[model samples]
Target chain A: MKISGAQGIIECLLEQGVDTVFGYPGGRILPLYDAIYEGKIRHILTVHEQGAIHAADGYARASGKVGVCIATSGPGATNLVTGLANAYLDSVPLVVITGQVSTDLIGADAFQEVDITGITMPITKHNFLVKDVATLPEIMRFAFRIASSGRPGPVLIDVPSDIQLDVFNFTQEEEQEKNKPRFQWELSQLGSSLIDRAAAVLETAKQPVMIVGGGVVSSGAYEQVVALAEKMNAPVVSTLMGLGSFSSEHPLFLGLTGMHGHKRANLAVHGADVVIAIGSRFNDRVTGNKFKYAEGKTLIHIDVDPAELDKNVSTHIPLAGDVKQLVTTLNERIKPFNPSPWWKVIWEWKQEFAVKPDGNDLSATWMLKQVAERTKGKPFIFATDVGQHQMWAAQNLHIETPRSWITSGGLGTMGFGLPAAIGAQIAMPTKRVIAIVGDGGMKMTGCELFTAASQGLPLITIIVDNSSLGMVRQLQQLFYKQRYSESLLPVPMDFVCFAKAFGIEGTLTTTQEEFLAAFSAAIESNCPRVIIVKIPTEQLVTPMLKPNSPLDTFMDI
Target chain B: MGHHTISILVLNQSGVLVRVAGMFSRRGFNIESLAVGTTHVPEYSRITAVMQGSDAIVAQVVKQLEKLVEVRAVEILPVNTAVVRDMAMIKVKAAQNKKLEVLQLAETFGAKVVDISNETLMVEITSGKTNTDALIDALSSYGILEMIRTGVVGLQRGDCSIYEKEKCEISALFDTAQVEA
Candidate 1:
């Protein structure tokens, strides 16, 4: 039963139910890679370590399981920071394993050595640097437990080269079992008094608006949220992180609420009598001017993390527990109540500010609508990068289920879509996955398309080419008097050529018909494909609130 | 803005101090004085940070600190109900002519003369903020040579401790938060 640390890692991952890992190999991690080469676990070699981490993040979001990734020390580990922070902010479960220099060479400034655990301390839920081979199994177990447990996030396990090569008896199950740390937080501790208080508040509310967050998806509480929303007859609005928690097609579903949210959604929150904020921390973007946000309303904040209760906005009643439990309890205790008048008011607002697709050539909005229509009544996953296209997708895509839509909400990291799509597709092979990306964001991590093509992922990447950083350009046009400096991509890059170079098929579209044809073709290709839709640079995401502006105030285009 | 003294209990792990400081700086909160040291439990470290801000901002800082995995507890110690102290050592020129006066002033402030030179006297004192300020102010007249002060460190006056369960067991709260998937 004796095994090398490298072999032990593979064994540990197998025991944790990990079927695949996304990683890039390097000098320090060669032994681990060798071990993986001899094992049955699938290891995806991404173009960059960042892409690997992001792909793992996407897999976790899509599969509802802890995603795993591996990298070598130094720059390899540094590149994972943004992805780690993204997962941390969104509460995605991930186990990131990094290879370190030999134990003797750790502090000697040897080649490819860095204090990765120190660098990732604030970003990860927990981290460990294994100097002893005997402790590897236990630390690996704890890493998974910590990553998937309460307020799940990425955990780092730094395995030194020597430890990986060292031999240890792998049959010490009794000792390893004893080392497993017992996580104490339980759902039963949530007392009934708070549920009673919340029910009373709901009973008295006339215009209630429920704010669902990513916590619902992370905790697998989608049905519970749907039940509560239906029972109360409340309009459901979501934070950017909360996008897929409730079905976007639901009648009561208002679109994404915040800086670039629907005009009606923000207005609904402004006029709400009771704000039931579930699993949301009220990001600054969502709460424009904190002091005035949800003012004069009874705030009921329910979350798994107690620290987020009053961190952003004030709360009248705080319920700290799992979203599933709290939502279920509320569903059982609270009676159905109709807010038809408020619904009518919201309907009027939606009608007044409804998005109208223009007849412009290859419009991103129109393309998204076509994709939504063609994919309607079917299961699909849409992942997006940050920018105008991201907002457009969130505002236009027909997301029908939880974990069906993925985007970088907290960090707003660009270059996230392609790799994330790769991850999601890998996690769910039978479902259709699409990457809706902008020119600016695609350029950041477009190289990952090579991974999708090489693996024959059958993923479609829709590149919304506006030839500029659309979001920042819009900001300049609005606030800087149209002096767009350093906001434009110097040269118009062609995604078709890039896709071809990566061994992927690509098509350029300048009209609605062409886009639909190219999209349909890509869907039929059964291989990774890119459809570049040329959008006009002047187009902007509407209903954006200026920084420091009140929540109710927005500059609608 | 009023100054507030807050104590944080954290797992004795690497880079935890940097994480706490980074959070404060990133959030635009300024720390007036800070001290960190191992506590009664070797597994825990107590970080005493003094910041000047409104009640809401201070509360936000505390909540953010509590979010860190290594941070086990966070408690804001009110001045009237906590024992807060700062230690300082001041070196002053004390020639034969002014030695008596310096010694007398030091006596009134309960300062200890840890180092004495032919022409200088180094007095060390551990006391609250107000007393330390007064002693420094009085000693300034004698042309103080050099001085150093350890930042404020505080603990609650009653039986309640920052590490105690009922006061601030952050891990316990997190454990309770873990719902079965």
Candidate 2:
């Protein structure tokens, strides 16, 4: 069983059920590359380390398993930070392995030596630097456990050059049996008693509304949420991160509720007699004008993270546990209420606040709706970068399952989509994967297209090009008196040419006919493809309420 | 303000001392002194830092420390009957100085001058906060120039270390139960 550290890595990955890894080989990681060559694990050589990490992230989101990425130390390791942070914010499970300098020369500032473990600590759930060859198997097991457990996140393991060259006997059974921390959802210990109290509140309330967040998605509790909502006969509003938790087409579904949420969604929250919040930390953006948000409503908060309860809005009842379990238990105890009257009132508001884009026949919003339709009922993963396109995708995409929509919510990290798409496609090869990105965001990590092409991941990327930072430009145009400063990127590179250079099929569309053709063609392609849709620069995401403003006060141009 | 025990795991790399010390200085967290050393893993190190701040401020400091990429895990360990120790190596000018007074002071504080030259005396002191402070105050009058103190290393008075015993037991029990099942 004596195997080199590099061989042990491949063995450990295979043990963890990892079939492929995204990485680029360098002098420091030559041993690992050689081992990969000798082993059966597929290695997708990315053009850049950032692309590797993003591809891994996409894979994790798409597959619902921990994605793996590898890179040499120093610059290569630093490049993965953005993608790591993206996965961290979105709660995607990822395991990143980086090659380090020799143990003896670790502190000598040797070539390609970087303190990756230290640098990645804040961005990772947990990280380890393997100095001893014996610890490699244990560390890899521990990394996978930590990355995939609790709130899923990215974990980094740095293996020194000397350790990679060292020999070790790593028994598969021993490695598999390596003990690690387990985050269990004990009903009693997690304060499930509060659910009874919350049920009482839900039972008596005249108008009850539900606010769901990304935690529901992370916990795979979308069905539970839908069931609870239907049983309660309550309208469900979602945070941007909570997109696709409830069927947008469902009668009980209220559009996204936040700073950029629909006016009716905000109004519904404000007018509710009782608010049942599940798996969502009431972030500042979601609770605009915090003092007045859900005014006079009895707030029943349910979250796994204890710190999130009563952190922003005052809660009458708080339940701490996994959202899925809590909702299922609550569904059994609570009595169903008739919401036809309340639904009628909310539907009227929804109709009044409904947004219809003008002039631009095929706007980004329209394109998203079309994409959602074309993909059919099969679960297609959507990874989005931040900007107008991200919000549009969140508002438009119909997510029927958990982990179907992956986007940086808390950190709002740009350049997240392309890399995340790469990860998702790798993780779930059978499903269609799409990266919906704005022009600004696409340019930030557009290089990852080459990574996608090289892997033949069959990921389809749709870039909403408006020749500027559309979100900022809209804000400046609407609120800042049209003083667009440092928001427009002049000499914008041709996206089609960029994708073509990466040896990937590319298309640019300016009209509805062209857009449909381009999108249809990209989806049919065997390899990764990019489709750029030219959008009007003046287009803005409508029904926008100013930050910290009441739901009643909104500006729509 | 109450005493807070901050446990930090860091990369066992050089310049870590300077970076950590500088953080304390810049943040003005009156470092009641610190103790650092390599852990069981050579690549990883542990540093126990003691500071006095309000609960809110201490939590803020812990959050800030956690934000540092170099800092691995940071937890505010509860200090109830904990064994905390600080070691200081002080070099005092012996010639024409109060050598007997310094030695007497050191003796009273259970400190010893390990190395002595004709003109300089190297005193090593390991004690609690009060004793360390008293020795520093007494030695300052004798022209104490060079002093290197190994911040503060501490452990709770218990049967075993937290990570070693508690984590191992829990994980072992879980593993055994899984295997048996």
DockQ by candidate, in order: 0.32, 0.09
For model 1, how does the per-residue alpha-carbon lDDT over B149-177 read when each residue is reduced to its tens digit? 99999989988977673222333212212
Expressed as tens digits, the lDDT of each residue in A1-557 for candidate 1 is: 98999999998998888999999999898899999999679999999999999999999999999999999988899999999999988889999999999988989988888999888876887788897898888788777877887788999999999899999988544546546555544444345777888899998898999998888888889988998999999999998888888888898899888998888898899899999988899899888989888679999988888778787888988887667777898889998999889899999998998877567566887788888899987879999999899998888888888898999999999888989999999999989899999989898999999899888899999999988999999999998999999898768787889999999889988888898889889888888889999877899887688676776788856
Instruction: Give Cα distance to truth, residue A196, candidate 2, Å.
Output: 2.4
**Candidate 2, residues A199-260: lDDT per residue as tens digits?**
88898888888999877877888888889998998988999888877777777888888887
| Chain B TM-score for candidate 2 | 0.69
After superposition, the stretches of candidate 1 with alpha carbons farther than 4 Å from their true spots are A171-192, A357-361, B166-181
DockQ of 1: 0.32
Q: Hey, what RMSD does candidate 1 come out at?
A: 3.1
Which residue pairs overlap in candidate 1's backbone? Answer: A184-B175, A185-B175, A185-B176, A186-B176
**Range of the 10 consecutive residues with the lowest summed lDDT in candidate 1 chain A:** A182-191
Please report the TM-score between candidate 2 and the true structure.
Answer: 0.81
Those runs of model 2 whose alpha carbons end farther than 4 Å from true positions after fitting are A174-183, A289-298, A307-318, A339-344, A357-360, A478-480, A490-492, A523-528, A550-553, B1-181
